[model samples]
Target chain A: MSAPIIAIDAMGGDYGPHCIVPACISFLAEHPSLQLVLVGQAPLLEDLIARSSIPALDRQRLHIHHASEVVAMDDRPSQALRGKPDSSMRIALELVRDGKAQACVSAGNTGALMALSRYLLKTLPGIDRPAMVTAVPTQTGSCHLLDLGANVDCSAEHLYQFAIMGAVAAEALGKVRPRVALLNVGTEDIKGNQQVKLAANLLQAASGVNFIGYIEGDGLYRGLADVVVCDGFVGNILLKSSEGLAAMISARLEALFASSLPARAVGLVAMPLLRRLRTELTPAQHNGASFLGLQGIVVKSHGSAGEEGFRSALRRAMIEVRENLPQRLHGRLEHLL
Target chain B: MSAPIIAIDAMGGDYGPHCIVPACISFLAEHPSLQLVLVGQAPLLEDLIARSSIPALDRQRLHIHHASEVVAMDDRPSQALRGKPDSSMRIALELVRDGKAQACVSAGNTGALMALSRYLLKTLPGIDRPAMVTAVPTQTGSCHLLDLGANVDCSAEHLYQFAIMGAVAAEALGKVRPRVALLNVGTEDIKGNQQVKLAANLLQAASGVNFIGYIEGDGLYRGLADVVVCDGFVGNILLKSSEGLAAMISARLEALFASSLPARAVGLVAMPLLRRLRTELTPAQHNGASFLGLQGIVVKSHGSAGEEGFRSALRRAMIEVRENLPQRLHGRLEHLL
Candidate 1:
C-alpha cells in the first residue's frame, strides 16, 4: 500500500511546533510508510524540527506549507476563517482538497477548522451538516458523541443524520450495530422538547440503526449508548462538562490522598488502583475528534495538546484513513438524504 | 415559632410509602416541632401510620388526606394533572394551596410535581416562570443550580430572572454576593448561540445579581461559580448528565477493583480514598430539589429516595421557609421584571 499523507497544523495547539515536531518524528519513526506535510511558518517549524531525531528519508518524506497567521484559541470561528485565508488550518484543508494529502489534522480553533473544512471540502452527498464527533472514555469503554460543537442549533432531521453518521463511525471502531441514543432531560420518549420528541419517534422507527431510546446528559461518560446524539449546542455542553467534572474529581482525589499521613499511606497502597483509574480517564488516551460527513478526513486535536496528545491525534487520523471512514460515511448517508 | 406543617406524598416515588413512612417517622423523631400530613390512599396511609411508633401528639400531627388516584411515573405532566385530579401529587400540592401545610415534599414524577406546583400554588409576584433548583455536590462544596427541569425552553429574559432567583437562594445558603454565571458552549463572550451571547451581555450588565461572565458545563461540579445559569433545558441536561456519569464511573471503579487478585489487593488499600471520593459524589449528600419562583416551599426528592433522602429534603424545605426565599426573590426581581 502507498504511504498515507497527513497534513498537520504544526503552529496550532498550546505548545505548537514544540509539541508537534517531536510527536510527528515519533509517529514517523513508528510508521515507516507514513508521509507528512507540516503547515506552519518555516523558520519556527525548521527550528523545532532541527532539534528532533527524525531520519533524513523521514525528513525527505516531510513537506512544509508556510503560513504566517496563527488563530488564537479564543478567536471566533467565522472571523478567524475569513480573516486568515492563508492560515495553517486553511492551507491544511487545501492539501486534502487538492488530493496532496489523504487527510488534515489540527489542534487549532475548532470552529474555524469545522467552518474551513465545510467551506473548502463541502459536506458529503446526502449529509446536510458535518459534525465533530469525539470519543469520551467511560467505565465500559469509550462512547462516541456527535456534533460536539459543529452546528449548535439542529432540527430533528439533523439529529437523525447525526445518529446514522455516528453509528457508522462507531461500527468502524468495532461496535457492531452500535446502540444509538438521543441525549435528553430524561430517559423516556415523552420527556424532552418538540425537537427531541420528534427525533426520538423517528429514531425508534428508523431502519438499520440500533435506537436505544433517550439517554440523559449524565449518561455521556457512562457508556450508556455507543453513540449519544444531540444538537451541537447540548453536545458541546455535555462534552465540556464531563471533561471539567472528571478533572475536578481527579484533583479532589489527589488532594485527599496528599492531605495527611493516614491518607498518604492509603494513597501508597492504592497507587496501582489510582493509576489504573487515572489511565482509564486520561483525555490523551481518547483524544481524536473526527469531523464527520466531510468529503475528506479531518481530525481535531486538543487546543492545549503537547507532544503525546498530538501523537495520539495523528494515530487516530491514521486509523480513520486506513478504515476509509469518510468514504464509508458517504456511502451510507448518501441514500438517506 | 410555630411548628411547620409539611405534606408528604406517601404513595409517590419508586419506593413509594415504604421510603416515605420511614422518612416521616425519622423526621418526627428528630424535630419535635414538625407536623406531617401524609397524602395518599386512606387504607395505605393508615396501615403505614399504624405500623410506626409515635406519641399521641405526633400521631395527631400526622393527618391523612386520601388520594385514590396515583400518577404513573411516565404519565405526561399536563395530561396527568388534568386527568388525575385526586392523585397523591395533586393532593399534596392542594394542601399547600389551601394553607393546610407550610410546604409539600415529594419523590414523584418531577414533571407532574412541577406542573402541580405551577397550577396550585402559582408563580410568586414578579416571577414569570418557576424553576427547579437543586444542590449539586461539587469538589469545592455544594452549589445551587436552578432550572434543573422546569421551563426547558427559556428566553434570555427568563434566564436573567433565574439568575436573580439562584443568587438569592445561594445567599440564603450564606454565599453573599454570589458569583452568577451563564452556562455556555465557551467562556468567551462571543462564543455560543445568540441566546447565550445576549444572556451573557445582559448578565454582565445586570446590577441586582452578581453576574460573572460565562461558565462552561464542566464548571458545575468544580464549584467555579456559585450560581450557574442556563435555560432549563440545558440545565436539566447538565444536571442529569453529570449525575449519570458520576454513578456510572463509580460503578465501573467497583467492577475494576473486583477484576483480579492484584486489582483486589489494590482495592483494599484504595477503599478509604475511594470511599471519601464516593462520599463527596453521593447523590444523598445533595438531595434537595427546590421548586424556585413559587409562593410556597416545595422540595422534590429522588424517586427511589429512602428515609435519609426524604429527611434531607425536609431540612432543605425548612431552611427555604425560614430564609423566606420566595419573598427575598420577589424583592430582588420585582424591579427587573
Candidate 2:
C-alpha cells in the first residue's frame, strides 16, 4: 500500500499547535509510512517545528498547510460554516475532500467540525445524516456510543441509522458481529421514548446487523453490548456526566490520600494501578469520536485533549482510513437500511 | 405535637421483608416518637419480624397492615395500578392519602410506584405532573436532580414546572433560594433543544427561583447548581449510567488489589478510604428518590437497596414529613406559577 497522508487541524482544541506539533512529530516517528499535513498559520507552525527534536527523515514526511483563520471553541456551527471559509478546521476537512489526505482529525469545535465535514464531504448513501460515534470503556472492553452530540433532535429513522452506522464502525474497529443495542431508561421492550421504541422495532427486522434488545445506561458499563445507540441529546449528556463523575472520584481519592501520613503511603502504592485503570475507562484515554456516515473519515478529539489525546485522535483517523470506514458503512446500509 | 407514623411497603423490593423488617426495627429504635405500619402479606412479614430481635417498646411502635398482593419488579405500571389494588405498595400510599400516616416509603417497581403515587395523592396545584427527585453527591456537597423517569415526554411548560418544584424541594430540603438550572448539552443560551431553551426563558423571567442559566452534565458533578432539571428520559439514564460507571471503577480497583500480595497489602490499607468515598458518591449511600410535586410525601427506595439503603429511604421520608415538602411546593407554585 502507498503511504497515507492525514490532515491535522493544528490550530484546534484549547492548547492548539503547542499540543499538536509534538504529537505530530512523535506519531510521524512511529508510523514510518505515514505523512501529516498540519493545517494552521505557517509562521507559528514552522517556528514550533523548528524547536522540536524531530529527525531530518521524519521532518521530510511532515508538511504544513496554511489556513488563515481559527474557529473559536464557542463558534456556532452555522456561523463557522458561512463565516470562516479559511479556518484550520474547514481547510483540514477540505484536504480530505480534495483527496490530499485520507482522513481529517481535529480537537476543535465539534459543531463546527461536523458542520464543515458534512458540507465538504457530504453523507454516504442510505444515510440521513452523519452521527458522532466514540468508544467508551466497559468491563470486557470498550463499546461504541453514537450520536454523541451531532444531532440533538433525531427521529426513529435517524436512531435506526445511528445503530446501523455504529455497528459498521464497531466492526471496522475490529469487533466481529458486534451486538448493537439502543440506549434506554429500561431494558424492557415497553420502555424508552417514541424514537427509541420505534428504532428498536426497525432494528429488530433489519438485516446484516446483530440487533440486541434495549440496554439501560447501567448495561452500557457492564459491556452488555458492543455498540450502544441513542439520540445525540441523551448520548452527549451520558458521556459528559461520566467524565464529571470520574473527575469527582479522582478528586476525592486525591483528598483522601493527602489527609494523613499512613494514608499517603497507601495512596502512593495504590495510585499507579488506579491511574492505569482510569486511563482504561475514562475520557483521558478514549479521546477520539468519529463523525460516522460521512463520505470521508473525520475523527474529533476532545476539545481539551492533551498531546497524547490529540495523537489518539490521529490514530483513530488512520485506523478508519485503513479500514475504509465510510465504504464499509455504505455497504452495510445497502443491506441493513 | 403528635408522633409521625410512616407506612412502609414491606414486601416491595427484591429481598422483600428480609431487608425491610430489619430496617424498620432499626429505624423505630432510633426514633422514639416515630411509628411504622409494615404493609405486606401477614404471615411473611410477621414471620420476618418475629425472627428479628426487636425491643418490646419498639415493637409497639411497629404495626402490621396486611395487603394480600405484591407488585413484582416486571409488573407494568397500569397493570400494577389496576390489578394489584391490594398490593403492599398501593396500601402504603393509601395510608398517606387518608392521613393515617405522615408519609409513605416503598422499594417497589418505580413505574408502579409513580403511577400509584399520582393516583392516590394527585399532583400539587399548578403542577401538571409529579417528578422523581434525588440528591446526588457533588464536589461541594450534593445537588437535587429531578424527573428520574416519570414524565419521559416533557414540554417546556413541564420543565418550567419542574424548575419551580425543584426549587421548592431544594429550599424545603434546607438550601436558601437554591439555584436552579436546566440540564443541557451546552451551557450557552443558544444551545440545547426547544424545551430547555424555552424553559430557560420561562425560568429567566419567573420569580421565587434563583434561576441559573443552562448547565451541562459535567457541571452537575462540579456542584455548580443546587437543582438540575431535565426530562425523565435523560435523568433516568444519567442516574443509572453513573451507577454503572461507579460499579465498573470499583470492580477494576478490586481486581487490581487482588492481583498481588504487595497490591493486596496496599489495597487493605487503602480500601477503607475508598469504600467511604464510594458510599459518598455512589447509589449505595444515596438510596431514596422523592416523588416531587405529589400532594403527599412518597419516597421511593431503590428496589435492590439493602437494609441501610431502605433505612436511608425511611430517613428521607422523616425529613420530608418534618418539612411538609408538599405544602411548601404548593405555596411556591402559587407565588411563582
Candidate 3:
C-alpha cells in the first residue's frame, strides 16, 4: 500500500511558500511515506522547496502542478471560482476529485475554498450543507465547534446536521460520547430566539449524538461541552471574536507586565507558567479549520498562518485522513437524514 | 444649587457593600458635596458603612434606607423585580422614582437592573426603548457600544434611536461630530440582514448624528467608529465575549511567561510594555455600563466588580452626570423621532 497524496495550495496565505514549503518539509519528515502534490505558481514553490533541508528522496515525494492564477484574499468566493476555474484552489480540489490526491488543503480565501470544495467534490450524500468545523481551546481541553463560518443562515435541521458531523469529528479525536451543545444566548431552553428555540427542540429529540442543552458564548472557552453547534454567522463571530480577543488580551497582558519593576519581576518569575497557558490558549496551536460534509477532506488554514501554524493544519489533515472522517460522517448521517 | 442625591444599590455585586462602600467613599473624597442614599439590608448596610474608612462629614453625606431582600445574579430581571419589591435593586430604583434620589446605580443582576429601571423611570419621551451602552477598549481609544443586552429584537427605528443616544453620549465625552456606525456582518451596504440594512439606511438619512456606513464585528475593537450600534443579542455577545476572552488570554499569557527560564527572562523585559497594553485593553478601567435612553443617568457596574472596578464605574457615572448626557440625548432624539 502506498502513502496518500495530499495536495498543498502553495501560493496562499500571508507567508505564502515560505510557510507552506517549510510545513510540507516538516510534515514529510514526520511521515516519510506521505506523498505531496504542491499546487500553485511552480517557480515560487520550487524556489522555496530548494531552501528546505529535506533529503532528495523526500523531495522526490513532492510534485508541483503549476497554476497561473491565484485568488486574492478579499475576492468573492463564487466570483473567483467562476472567473478562475484553473486557480490553485480550484486545481487542488480537482486533484482530490481525480483521485490524484486523497485530500486538499488551502490557507487561501476561506469563502473561495469552501465554494470550490462544494463545486468540485460536491456535498456528501445525506448532508444538506457542508460545514466548517474547528477546535476551540477551553479550560478542560479542546472542544470542536461546527459551522464556524459556512451556511450563514441555518435552519433548525441544519444545526441538527452540524451536531452529527461535529460529533463524528469529536469521536475521531478520541472524545467518547462527545457532548453536543447548541450555542445560544443562554442555557435555558426558552432563552434564545425562535431559531435557537426550534434548534434546541430538534437537537434534544435527535439520537446518536450526546445532545447536551444550550451553551452560551462564555461556555465555549470554559470547556463545558465537547461539541458546540451554531450557524455560520454566529460561529464566525465566535471564532473571530475569540481569536481577536485572544490577541487583544495578549497585548494587554504584555502592557500590564511592563507597567512597573515589581510587575516585571512577577512576570519574569511567572514566565514558564505564562508560556504554558499561552500554548493552551493560542487557537492556531489547537485546531485547523476543517471543511466538513465534503466528499474529500479540505482543511483551511488561517490566511495569516505562518510555518508553525501551517504545520499544525497539515497535522490536523493527517489526523482526519487517518480516521477516515468523511466516510464515518457519511455513515452516521446517511440513515438519519 | 444642591448636590444630586444618587441612590446606591448597596447589596448588589459580588463584593456587595465591601466594594460599593469604598467606591462611594473614594467618589465622595473627590466630589465632597455629592449626596448618596444607600439602599440594602438595613443591618448589613449600617455595619458596613460604620466600618468604612469614610470621614465623619463624608458619613453625614450618606443616608441608609434598609431593604431586607437581594436579587441573585442568575435571577430573571422581570421575575425578580416582581417577586422582591424590597430587593436592593428595586428600592434603589424606587428612590429615584419617588424623587428621594436623582439617579440610581446597581452592580446587580443586569436583567433586573434593566427591568426595574424601565419599570420605575420608564423610557424618555420618543425613546422607544432604553439601551445598555458600554465602553469597549480599542487600539485608538474607547468607543461606545449600545444595546449591549437590553432589547434582543430591535426594529430599524429602535436602532436609529440607539445611534442617536450613542452619538450624544460620545459628544458628552467630548467627541464632537462622533462617527456613528451600524454593526453588521460586513461593511458593504448590501450586507447583513434586513434589520441592519434598514438601520444603515435610516442612520445615513437621519439628521444630527454623523452616520458612518456599516462596521463589521472586527471593527468594534479597531476604533473605526466613535459609536457602534447593534441589537441587544449581538451587543451582549460582543461585550461578554470580550470580557471572557480578555480573562482567558490574560490567564494564558501568565502561563506562557511562567513556562520556562528563557521565556521568564523574555517576560521580564517585556513586562512594562505588557502592563501598559493590558491597562489599555481592560474594559473595566474605562467606563461602566450605562442604561441609555432613560430619563436619568444610571450606570450598571459589573456584578463581579471589585473596589477598583466600582470606582471606575462611579467615575463614569460622574462624567455622564457632569456632561448632562440624558438631556442632550433627549434633545437630539426627540426631534428626530
Candidate 4:
C-alpha cells in the first residue's frame, strides 16, 4: 500500500528535462500519494527541479535518477538498443525491470521506446509481441485501441492476442465485459482480408470475450464498441488520420471565426466547446499511448509535447500503475489462450 | 464534342431505384449537355422517372437501358460477377465497354463494382490493378486519395502506380503535378512498413512524379499533398474514420446548440457553416470514389447515399467523362513507366 513510484525519462522527447520536469512536479502536487523518479543527466535534472520553486512537501516525493548518456531523437531503435546502454530511456525501463518503478513513461523516439521496452521488459506469457494501446476519445466516452505501431505485420493469432489484451485493458479503464470488435473495411463477414476473418473466427469462439463482430473506422469514433482491435499497420494509420482531421477542422473553425465580427462574437462563446470537441474527436491527442502485453507498463508520449501534454502522459502511467494492468493481463492470459 | 452519356446502376445500393432514378433525372436537368441511361429493372425505373414529371426537353436526354437482374446487397463480388451478368451494376459497366456510355456510376456492392469493372474494362497497359480515388476535403481544399477499397493487399509497385494515377486524376480535378505522397504512420524516412518504404524509394527515384516525401493521415486533411496514396485497407479505414468522426462532431454540436436558448440563437447562424464543414471533412461523404487505372471510367457511390449524394456520384462520372480520365491515364503511362 506504499506510494507507487513512476519513472520518467527526463531527457527524452524533442524538448528534454525542461518540458518533463515541470510536468512531473505538477503531477506530484496534484496527486499526493504517487512518487516520481526523473531519470536523466544528474546536474540538469537537479537544476530544472531547483528552478521550478515547488513546495517542499511535493518536492520530497520527486527523486532524480542519473544516466550520463541521452538517446537522440534521430537514433535508430536498434542502434539505440545496441548502443546507449546508459541512456535515460534504457535506464527508466531497467528500473521497471528491476521493480524500482511500477511504470516508465517517455516522449522520445517511438521505435526506440518500443524496442527498449520489448527488449528490457519482455512480453507476458502467451503474448508474442508487445502492442501499443491508447485510449482514443469517442463520441460517448473513449475506447481502448491497440497495436498502435508495435507489430505491423500481425497474424490472426496476434490479432486475437490484441483483442484479449485490449478487452482486459479496457476493463482497467472502467468498462464491464467490454464489447470487443475488429477494425475492418466493412462490417460484413466477407469484407476484410484473410487475417481479419480468421481473427473474427477466433474471437467468436473465445469464452470470456464479448465479441461484437466487425466494426469499420467510423464505428471507432461513434463509440460502437469499447475495445477495438487491429494490427499495428492499420491502427497507426487510423490514429494518425484522426489526429490530422481533427487538427484541420480546428484550424478551419478558427479561420471562420476570425473572418467576420459576428462570427468572432459567436466564436467567443463557442471557442472553448469547439476546442474541447476537437480534442474529443482526435484519438491520438489523448496523449498517453502505452505499450501493451509487456511485462511492465511503458507509456509513449508525443515528442515536443508541452507541459500539459507531458502531464497527461504521466497521468496515464499512474492509472496503469494503480490498476496493476500487466498483472491483470497476466492473470487473464491463461483463459484467453 | 458530343454530349457525354453516363450509365447509372439504378437498382444498386441499399435503396435501389427509389434513391437513384430521381438523382439521374436531376443530373440530366442540371447539366443540359450531358445525357444519362438508367440501367436497372425497366418497369421500376420507368415508373419512378415518369413519377418525377420531368420536362420534355431534359426527358429526351434521359434513356432507360433495362437490366433484368439485381445484385443483392449481401452478394459476394465473385458471386455477383459470375452469377448476375444482367445485373444493374454489370449492365452499367457494359454500357461503357460497348461505347454507348462514356462512363458508368454505381452505388452497388463495392466488390461487385470493382470486380465487374475490371472484368469488363480491364486495366490499362503497365497498370497492375485499378484503384479507387476520391477527393477528400482538407482545411484549404481537397486532396485526391487513392486505393479507397479496390486492392486490399498492395505491393510497392501497386502503390507507385496509384501515385501516377492519382496525380493524373488530380490534374483532371485541376492541380498542377499534384504533390504526391505515400500515406504512412509517420513522415519520417524509417517510419512505415516495408511495402511503404519500398514504395517511397520507387516514388523518389521515378521521374514525372512530384514526390513530396511521406505524409501521415493528418497531412491528408491538412491539404499538404494533392495526392495521397495508400493500400486499400489503410485508405478505406482513413476515409471511414473521418466520416465517423465528422458525423459524431456534428451531432455533438447540434446537441450543444439545442441545450439552451442563447446557444440555439448562435446555432442558427452557425448551422449552415457547420453542415458544410461536416460534408467537406468527410472523404466518404464526397459520394464519388472512381476506379482509376481502368481502360474506362467507373465511379462507385456510397451504397446508402441519399438523392443529393447520388447526384454527386453522377457529377463525378461526368467530370471523368469530360476529362477522358482513362485515356489520360493511358497517355501518362508511357511517360511514367
Candidate 5:
C-alpha cells in the first residue's frame, strides 16, 4: 500500500511547532508508511525541524508547506476565515479537502477549525452540520459523545443527525454496532426538554441505529451506551465539567499525599500504580475529537496539549485515515436515510 | 428563636423509615432545640423506632405522624399525586404548609416532591417556577447551582428568575452576596444559545444581583461564581454526570490501591488520610438539595441515602429553617422584581 499523507497545523497550539514537530517526529518514527506535511510559517517549521531529533529516513518523509498566518486561539470562526485565508489551520484542512492528505489534525481555535472545515470540506449529504465527536473513558470502556460544542442551539433534526453520524463513527472506528442514546436529565421517556424528547423518538424510530433510550451524565461515564448524543451546549458543558472535576480530584489527591510524612511514604510506594492510573484516566489518552459528518476527516487536538497529547490526537487522525472513517460514515448514513 | 420542627418523609426513600428514623434520632440527640415529625405508615415506623435504642428525653423530641401510603422512586409525578394522595411525602409537606413544621425534608421521588410542594405551598410572588437548588463542592468552597432538575426547557425569563432565586438563597443561606453566573458553553457574550445570551443581558441589567458573566461546567467546580444558573435539562445532566464520574474515579482509585500486595500495604498506611478525603468529598456530606422559589423550604435528599446521608439532609433543612430562608427569599425577590 502507498504511504498515507496527513497534514498537521504546525503553528496552531499554544506552543505552536514546538509541540507539533516533536509529536510528528515520534509518530513518523513509529509508522514507517506514513508521511506528514507540517503546514505553518516556513522559517519556524525549519527551525523546529532542525532541533527535533527525527531519524534521517523518517525526516525525509516529513514535508513543510508554508502558511503565512496563524489563527489565534481566541479568534472567531468568521474572523479567522475572512482575515486569515493563509492560516496554517485552513491550509492544513484544505490539503485534506484537496486529497493531498487523507486527514488533517489541528490544535488551533476550535471555532475556526469547525467553521473552516465545514466551509472547505462541506457536510456530507443529508447532514446539516458536523458534530464534534470524542471518545470518553467509561467503566466498561470508552464511548463516543457528539456535538461537544459545534452547534449550540441544535434542533431535534440536528440531534437525529448526530445520532446517525455518531453511530456511523462508532461502527467504523470502534468496530461495534453502536448503541446510541440521547443525553437527558432522567432516563424516563417523560423526562428532558421538548428537543431531547423529540430527538429520542426520532432515534428510536430510525433503522440500523441501536437507540438505547436516554442516558444521564453519570450514565455517559458508566459505559451505558456506545454513543451519547446531545446539543453542543450540553455536550460542551458535560465535557468541560468532567474535566474540571477530574483535575480537582487529582489535585486533592496530590495534596492529601503531600500533607503528611506517612502519606508521603505511602505515595512513594504507590507512585508506580498511581502513575499508571493517571496515564489511564488523563485527558492526553483521548486528545483528538473528530468533526464527524464532514466530507473529509478532521481531528481537533486540544490547543493547550503537550507532546504526548498532540501525538495522541495525530494518532487518532491516522487511525481515522486508515479506516477511511468519513467515507464509511457516508455509506452508513446513506443507508439509514 | 423557637426550636424548629422538621417534618421528614419517613416512607419516601428506598429504605423508607429505616433510614429516616435513625437519622432523625441522631439529629435530635445532636440539637437540643430541634424537633422532628417522622411521617409514614405508623406500624412499620413504630416497629423500627421501638427496636432502636433511643435516649428517653431525645425520644420525646421526635414525633411520628402516620400516613397510609408511600411515593415510590419510579412513580410519575402526576401519577404519584393522583394515586397516592395520602403519601408520606405529601403529608410532610402539608405539615409545613399548615404551620405545624418549620421545614420539610424528603428523600422521595424528586418529580413528586417538586410537583406536590408546588401545588401545596405555591411559588413565591414574582416567581414562575420553583427551581431545584443545591450546593456543589468546588476548589475554594461550595457554590449554589440552580434549576438542577426542575424546569427542563427554561426560557430567558425562567433563567432570570433562577438567578434571582439562587442569589437570594445564597445570601439568605450561604450568607454572602452571591456572585451569579449564567451557565454556558463559553464565557464570551457571543457564545451559547439565544436563551442564555438573552438571560445574560437580563441578569446584567437586573438590580441587586452580582451578575458575573458566563461560566462553563468546569468553572462550576472551580468556585468561580457563587450561584450558577442553567435550564434544568443541562443542570440535571451535569449534576448526574458529575456524580457518575466521581463514583467511577473513586472506584478506580480503590482498585488501584487493592491491585497488589505492595499497593495494599501502601493503602493500609494511607487509610486515615484517604478516609478523611472520602468524608470530605462524599455525597453524604452535602445531601440536601433545596426547592428554591417556593413559599416554604423543602430539602430533597438522595432517594437511596443511608443513615448518615439522611441526617445530612435533615440538618440542612434545620439550618434553612433557622435562617427563615423562604421568608428571606420572599423579601429579597420582592426588590428584584
Candidate 6:
C-alpha cells in the first residue's frame, strides 16, 4: 500500500531548481498516490521550494536528496560519465537503480544522461543499445519514434532491436498491436541503403512486430504507423528538422501579425484558435524523450524546459511507472527476440 | 544568339500532358524568348495543348517532340533505364545530352531520372555522384539543401563532393559566398556518425567554401546557412518529414477552425492571414528539387504536382540554365577537390 516514488533531478535544467521545484509541487498536487525525491543541491532546492506556494501536506510528500555536481549542457558524455559521479542527473538514476524510486526524470544533457544511464543501470537482456523514444504528434494521435540520437551508425541488427523495443513501448503506452514501419527516403522495397534493406527483411520476418513495409518521412506525421523506426542519425535529423520548421513557422506567424493592423486584429480575434494550434504543435507539450530499452524507466526532459514543460516530462515518467513500461518492454522483447 | 530551348517530359507526371502542357503554356507567356520541346506521345500533348489557352504567338515557341513510351512512377529505376529507352523522361534528357536543349525538367519517377541522367549527361568532373538539391522555404529566403535522395549510402568523400557542389550551386543561385554547414544530429563537431565527422573535416579543409561547422535539423529552416549539406538519405528524410509535418499541421488547423461555429467565424475573419500562411509554407510554392553536380541542368518536380507546381519546376530549370549552375559547380568543385 505504499505510493510510488519518482526521483527528480532538480538542478538539471537551464534554470535549475527554479523550474524543477515549481513543476514538482504542481505534479504532486495532481497525483495523490505519488511521492517525490528531489535530487540536487539541498540548499538551493530548499530556497526555491520556500519561495513557491506549495501546501504543507504536499511539502511533506516532497523529499530532497543532495548532490554536489551538475552536468553542464556542453559537457561531453564520456567526460560527464567519468567526472560527474555526484551529479544530480547521476543521483536521480541511482535512486531508480536502488529501488528508491519507480522512475527517474531529468532535464539534463541528453548525451550525458544516455551514457550514464547505460553505464549505471545497463540495457535489458537481448538489447545491445537503448534507443531514445519520444511521442511525435501526428494526425490520428502521436507516433512513437525511436533512436532519436543513440546509435548514429546503426546496423540491421540494431534497427531490428529498436523495432522490438519500440513496438513493446508503443503497446505498453496503450497502442494495441502497434503497426511498425521502417523510416526511409521512399516507401518502396529498394529505397534506402544495404542496412535499411537488411533491416526491412529482418523486421518483416521478425515475430511480434506488425511490420508494414517501408514508410517515408511525410508518411510519419500522417500517423501511418504506431511506431516509426530509423537509425539515430536519420531519426535525429527528422525530429530536429520538424522542430526547426515549427519554430520558423511560429516566428513567421508572429511577424505576419505584427506587420499590419488588419492582420493583428484578425490574430486577436483568432487568439483562442491560435493558442490551440500552438499547444497542439509545440515540442514542450511533448517534452519527455524516454530512454527505452534500459533496465529501469528514465525519462529525459528538454534541457531548456520551462515549468509546464518540466511538469509534462514528470507526468510522462509517472505514466511510465504506472504502466510498468520497462518490465513490459523486457517481457515482450524476450519473447520476440 | 537563339533563345534557350528547354526539354519537358510531358507524359511523365500523374496527369501526364494534362499537367505538363498547361504549365508549359503559362511559362511561355511569361518569357517570350524561352522555347519548350514537349517530349511524349505527341498526340496526347498536342490534344492537351489544343484544349489549353495557348495564343498563336506563344504556340510558335512550343514544339512537341514525340516519344513512344512513358516511365511509370513505380517502375524500377534500372529496369526503366534499360527497358524504356524511348520513354518520355529519356527523350527529354537526350535533348539536353545532344545540346539541343539547355536544360530538362520532369515530374516523373525520381530514381529513373537520376539513373538515366547520370547515364546520359554524366556527372561534372571530380564529382562522383550527383546530389538532388532543392530550395526549402525559410524565414529569410530559401536555403539550398542537397543530397535529397540520389545516393543512399554516402561516404565522407561523397559528402565532401556534395558540400562543394551545394556551395557552388547556392552561390550560382545568387547567394554571395554561400555559408555551407554540414547537417547532423547536433551542431557539435562530434555529434554524428564517422562519415559525417570525416565530411566535416574535409569541408573545413576545402577552399572556396565558407565552411561553417555543424548545423542541426532545426537550423535548416532558420536560414542559419545558405547551403545545408548531408548525405542523400538524411537529406531526403528531412525534406519529406518537413513536408509531412507541414501537411499534418495544415490539416489540423482546418479541422480546428471547422470544429465549431465560433471558430468558423474566427476562421472567416482570418481567411486572408491563413491564405498568406498557406502561400508561404505550402510545398507547392517550393516544388522543384534540382539535380546538382550533373553535367547539365535537370530539375525534378513532384510526380503528382499540379499545373502551378509543374510551372515552378520549369521556372527553376530556366533559372539554372541562365545561372549556368552546372558549369559553375564544375569549375568550383574542380578547385575545391
**Estimated TM-score per prediction?**
0.95, 0.98, 0.89, 0.97, 0.97, 0.97
- What's the chain B TM-score of candidate 4? 0.97
Chain B, per-candidate TM-score: 0.93, 0.98, 0.94, 0.97, 0.96, 0.96
DockQ of each: 0.64, 0.86, 0.32, 0.78, 0.77, 0.80
- Tell me the spans in candidate 2 whose CA falls farther than 4 Å from its real position: none
Error of 1 at A158 (Å): 1.7
Q: Which is the winner by lDDT between candidate 3 and candidate 6?
A: 6
True-structure lDDT of candidate 2: 0.89
lDDT tens digits, residues B1-337, model 2? 5899999999888888988899999999899999999999999888888888999989999999989999999999999989988999999999999999989999989999999999999998898999999999998998999889888899999999998888888888899889899999998877899988999999899876799899988999999999999999999999989988988888888888889998898889778777777666656335689899898999998888888889999999999999988988887788887
| Candidate number achieving the greatest DockQ relative to the actual structure | 2
CA lDDT of each prediction against the hidden true structure: 0.81, 0.89, 0.79, 0.88, 0.86, 0.86
After the best TM-score superposition of candidate 5, give how far the Cα of residue A76 lies from its true spot, in angstroms: 0.9
Q: For candidate 6, lDDT tens digit of each residue in A1-337?
A: 3699999988886878887888899989998778999999999888888988889999999999999999998999988899889999999999999999988899888899999999989999999999998888898998989988888989999999999889888887889999999998888777889888999999888876899989998888889999999999998888878877877776776676677887677567565665566655656335678899898999988877788888889888888888898889888877878
Please write out the lDDT profile of model 3 over residues A1-337, one tens digit for every residue.
Answer: 3588889888888777788888898788889889889999999888888877789889999899999899888788767779997788889889999989888888988878988989899998878789998887876677898887677677888888888889999999899999999887677654766777887877777777688898876677677899998877667666665655565554555566667887677666554555555544556434468988989999988888777778788888888888988988889877667
Q: Stretches of candidate 4 above 4 Å error?
A: none
DockQ ranking of the models: 2, 6, 4, 5, 1, 3
- What is candidate 5's lDDT per residue for B270-321, written digit by digit as tens? 6666555555454423477889888898999888777887888887888788
Kindly report the root-mean-square deviation of model 6 from the true structure over all alpha carbons: 1.5
lDDT of model 3, residue A259: 70
Interface RMSD of each: 2.4, 0.9, 3.8, 1.1, 1.5, 1.4
Question: Which runs of model 6 end up more than 4 angstroms from their true locations?
Answer: B282-285
What does DockQ come to for candidate 6?
A: 0.80
- Per residue, candidate 5 scores C-alpha lDDT tens digits across A243-333 of 8777777677777788799888887876666555555554533467889989998988887788888888888888888888888888887
Query: In each prediction, how many residue pairs overlap at the backbone (N, C-alpha, C within less than 3 A)?
Result: 3, 0, 40, 1, 2, 0
